[model samples]
Target: MELNQRKGKVMIEQTLEDALSEVYLQISPNILESFPKFRPPVDLYIYDQAVAQVKKFHRAEARLGTEKQAVVATFARENLLFLLRDDYRVYAEHLSRKLGLVLVEDDFKAREVSEIFFIAFRDRMDVFLSQPKIEPFKELLRDVSILAEYLWTDPCRVEFLTKTLHKEYDLSVHSVNTMFIGLGLFVMASGARPERMEVVNLALGLILHDLGMTNVPKFITDKTQYLVWRDRGSIENHINAGLKKLERLEINDPTVRQCMSQHHERLDGSGYPEGLRADSMSMAGRLCAVADSFSAIIGDRPYHSSKVFNEAAGTLIADKGRYEPALTRLLVGLLKEGFPGCVGEDMN
Candidate 1:
């Protein structure tokens, strides 16, 4: 079973001695005795099989291992030794070409935003949340301004949005979608060109809207059943905690502060942290409240399954006076147009 490098070519067969020498040289001594009948110049197919058999007992330890180690463990362990010779190189090259193709395809899809931007945003969020002082929050505001510039000028491509929605896990995904929804609403409502500072503030509020949840214990956050009264109270306080943290950070913009503080406030005075009614709510605060609530209804939550798009929309509409009716209608319309409902199966 000679393995040929060129497709469809035969591989050279080898004696047991030749196979043993090659095998021993390539593998560790601890694993060598397991295969005593090893032959040299053996068919590449048989060689691959032998290597595979040995690997079955020796698992690879690292996520990224050497090519030779990968080849031996993958193809060889499966007993396809005939692929060892030229076939191995050919297969490696084929895989390389395939990876290159995939990367090119991803580049085409990712033209609107770079991976670097997302990484930077995530890192900045971590720093903003962890900083014991106020300076980092200010720095975070600057970085977020740059991020907003990218979003406002270039805008995320449809594919970029789809990919991000699919790739992100729960909390991050919710945060990103809320930012997009809030920004869209701000654009529609303001009429004026979105000022860079306003966009940055909006982005910061959207991203950190749930930051206080970090204070909530995992047991409470992850409870699949309805939270008990005490737990429920704790959960409610997360909003207050978030506002206090922002206040400590010296975030002085009333719109920004209200966006964070009143996101949970209802028009009926039923909401938390003072529960100021609609007449007293700032427009920014109202928009954030609507966006945050709508996104949450459509998104999967700890104790509840995600509501269907229409159902979630109806709930928002039912809130009516509690939320701005016109804005609610626009959001429902956006949902109807098939932007993936904020929650449920992967968007793509």
Candidate 2:
């Protein structure tokens, strides 16, 4: 009878998990605001490992009353928790508050909040890749604006953002990393506050700099052997391909075009497509170049093993004239202060 009861409990738990998966979203309790003037209509659930079941901590209306303290404390103490997916806007607002507070308190909860942001950003990017539509791209631009504002205010959130980078090598993940790291480097190096529009434009450019790579044949990208001129030519053509696609999308921003066109170009005129020298390259182009190179180097590829952050930063710095000296130094500084050391290995 005890064995039967155990089996029945397991089945019930599985059913609960499945049912909740549809209506609820798992959330880190760290971002929950202990008190808010406006609490959204949403139920909160905490999974009790002792009983192996999820239990409602508080109903939607209860959160508006004095029971709020209890709800926050209980959720913060629990390991597994869920919130109504319908109330995501409330959660986003809560995250915004937490992000601002974490910076003031010199707290680590920034990682928790930013990790959620990163996941959502990556999901949006995935949709854009599959659809490649104007709406999705516009939504991505909105995210870029938020990120730029975040960095513009603190500039140090780059450290927390780095911790959230998905070590897995994919176009979406790489693009996101480049955007975050590039914007961080740009903000850090600029000293004086940058215009909001400049930051947004650069952010968008960094994220889409490799958009052309989607047009290349997978076999060429995945090739393990030496590439002939034809193969190299095909790979290098991604710039034009990405630019053409953007043009079709009606994206006429010169900053965006510069990033897509010049990220591969070296300061010493050793790059492809256009062999533009240092004097000809824009700062946005240089910023994207360093960011693209660093993000790619630290991530594993079909052709090469991933380099550690220190090694990758050193490699870029060692290249001397290939990359801009000031930007490489900024990259090094960012790594020294922010890099968590382990990457592409244990990062899940």
TM-score to true structure, per model: 0.58, 0.69
Whole-model Cα lDDT of every candidate shown, in order: 0.55, 0.72
lDDT of 1 by residue, 324-347 (tens): 887888766655652332232223
Instruction: Summarize candidate 2's per-residue lDDT along 33-61 as a digit string, tens digits.
Output: 43353453467766565576567766765
Q: What are the C-alpha RMSDs, in order, of all predicted structures?
A: 13.5, 11.4
Model 2 score (lDDT): 0.72
Residue 152, model 1: Cα distance from true site in angstroms: 3.8
TM-score of 2: 0.69
Rate residue 310 of model 2 by lDDT: 76
